[model samples]
Target: MKFAAVLNRDGGTLRNADLAALCDRMCQTLETAGHSLSIDVVAGKDLVDALDGATSRRSVDIVLAGGGDGTISAAAARLMGTKKALAILPAGTMNLFARGLGIPQSLEAALKSFTDGEIIAVDMATANGRPFVHQFSIGMHAKMVQLRQKMEFGSRLGKIRASVKAAWATINNPPAMNVTLSIGKAEIAARITGIGITNNLFGEGHLPYADNPAGGVLGVYVTVAQQRTELLKFFFNMARGKWRDNQHVEIHQADRTVLKIHSGSSKFRAVMDGELVRLDRETTVEIQPGALNVLVPASIAKAEAA
Candidate 1:
């Protein structure tokens, strides 16, 4: 098969001596798997267009994205609904989407799995027409993404620090957002601190299916924690995947939702996949299932079959 490997060298740390070496190893691994490969290292936002060119010109069968969640989200946007399949390299912190796919974080291990993997149809959701593979979130999680992105130590602490810092900041200044949500025939309103719409259901302790991305529904989680004590309880429940146990948090499954947020005295940040986006008083999220084809470890597929 012909493959286009789109790697983002600057997606993680801006300075690195191993960039060239990592690319070389990736190339060698794919070529050894009997694939005709074309490689490019995306440095900035413009590289998305460049990657589009490489894949289209080569008539690539698969595109391997080597970056963090944002880079993967960018490449996935281009690859979604196409005949091509996407494989993640997970060079960035968190790599939430990659972890969901059961892709190994180590470059060599991931590349090997790529060659051994099989393509699976997975759902992708859109927020205001923007594609997100894993999740679209509003509220405290969004603020965390924003705060960590602005921090000078992003590359230094990697994903773990970014998560920790975001958690800390969110706790310090929790969002008290008044949200009006319409899901299907139900019109509901509440004052919430955060909202998450997931293509595949995943929470702090829950395990999303590794082999099936096309679950055909979106998981919507609303956080209603408004006070510090309530927030602590919310965290405790999240650790056990029993967040729904808390009356402060609500979970629903929906095909689509229209949301309006009254930010009031505080700012609102929205995170799509892992990218931070700010929302005004109103925004809409629609679930578009089977929007992307992904590659997953073959073993996962067999497990599902059994």
Candidate 2:
């Protein structure tokens, strides 16, 4: 097997000499599994272009992405609809998407997935034609990301601190977006403070994790809290996985949905699979059934089968 491994050298946990060492270790691991590899150390924002170039070579069968969900989603945007399969190396703070796939966050355990793994075609949600692996959201969640990205926090804990600050900022100016949402033929008009559309259902209230990756449905979570205090309370409950019980929140599922913002502005800011995006006009959030081929560890496969 031939692989093109792209590491987010600057933004992830591993940095400088440490990142280089991890890359070397990753290459060694792949080679030991009787596979050849070419590694690229790129900045987080440049990952999509780098991976796009790597895949254009058509010399590699799989692209191994190492970083947070943002970096992974960037690669997914480029790799979507392609014949190549994605192999994730969970080099992030939370590794929610990796965890959802049953990929262990530890480097050694994640590396072992490629050694003896099976490619599973999974659903990938799209927000206005942009492919996302995890989710795309608008309002408060997007506001948090918008603020979190601006903060210069070098460490993971610093990121948490930054998120807290972002939450406060969001509370100061609560988001109230009036929109008409269409799920199938059902039209609903509401003022939504935040809405999350994940590639799969989140079950009851699993926080940021996907309940079923191959369920072929999009989980739609909408928050109706309109006040500053209500926004904070809603987010607090969400963090504790109690948001579903809150009367201000609504959770549902669909294979496709359309969201149209009411009058006000032409374009709105959104969070796309952990990345910030500015969306103009009505956006179609839909599931592309079995659109992405992802490789998972043999252990995960066996466990799922069991």
Candidate 3:
């Protein structure tokens, strides 16, 4: 297969990486495996353009995007419903989407995985017609991301620390809004602190990312905690992957959902795959089963199939 690799120069761990050496290694690795590869290292501001250019090429079969979750999400959005597949290089803080895809977390290991990777179709979700590989969240998660982005963080560890601090701040002063959730014929109205709609149901373990990206449903979680203590407990349970046991959270699954936010503010913000964006008063969220083609470690793919 022919691959076009786009490395985000300003994303997470890649900010301090040797791009030239990495590109050389990628080319050599892929070529040795009977595949051809071309690489582009671009600034964050130019990432979208680079991705667009790479996807537009007729010679490219797979686009190997190297960066954090946001970069991978952007690449996935560009490749939706297309014949090209996406290969992820996890060079970020959490690398949640990479985790869901079962890609190696380390750069070197991820590169080697591509030598024997298999292409598989996975589910992708969308918010207001915009594609996302991960979750679309509002309230607490969005507020935390907004707060963390304001603080200076150089390295991956620094970013994690900043995120922890932001999470604590959000927990202390959580935002609440009137939300109407519509799933199928059922409609539920509630005052919630936060809400998240994931691409698939999050598996129980260490992180909140989905273990089965091929699950053709959206997982909706709404937090109704009002007091600081309740909010703190909810977050604690979520961190321990015991959110299902938390009474403050309501979990539901659906093929599609409509969210209407009744916040008084004219402008609202939400987090879509870790990037903050303006939110519409009413947003339609839905899962597209097997809409995205991704490259995963061959062994993992075989094991899952078995």
RMSD from true fold, candidate 1: 2.6
Any idea what lDDT model 3 has?
A: 0.92
Ten residues in sequence with the least summed lDDT for candidate 1: 203-212
lDDT of every model, 2 decimals: 0.75, 0.80, 0.92
* lDDT order of candidates, top first: 3, 2, 1
Error of 2 at 42 (Å): 1.8
RMSD of each: 2.6, 2.0, 1.0
- Ranked by lDDT, the better of candidates 1 and 3 is 3
Q: What is the TM-score of each candidate against the true structure?
A: 0.89, 0.92, 0.98
Highest lDDT: give the candidate number: 3
Which lDDT tens digits does candidate 2 get at residues 1-306? 888988887655655338767877887888998999999888766876888887787788899888877777877777788889888888777777777888878888888778888777777888877788888888888878887888898877788899899989988886778888899888889988888888897654565777567788998888888877777788788776675668888888899999888846444588886667786668899999878878898877676667
The superposed Cα distance between candidate 3 and the true structure at residue 238, in angstroms, equals 1.4
- Quickly count the clashes in candidate 3: 0
lDDT of 3 by residue, 1-306 (tens): 999999999997899998888988999989999999988999999999999999999999999999988999999999999989999999988898898888988889999999989999999999999999899998999989999989998998899899999999998788888989998899999988899999999988668899899989999999999898898888888887887889999999999999998876455588999999988899999999999989999988897788
TM-score of 2: 0.92
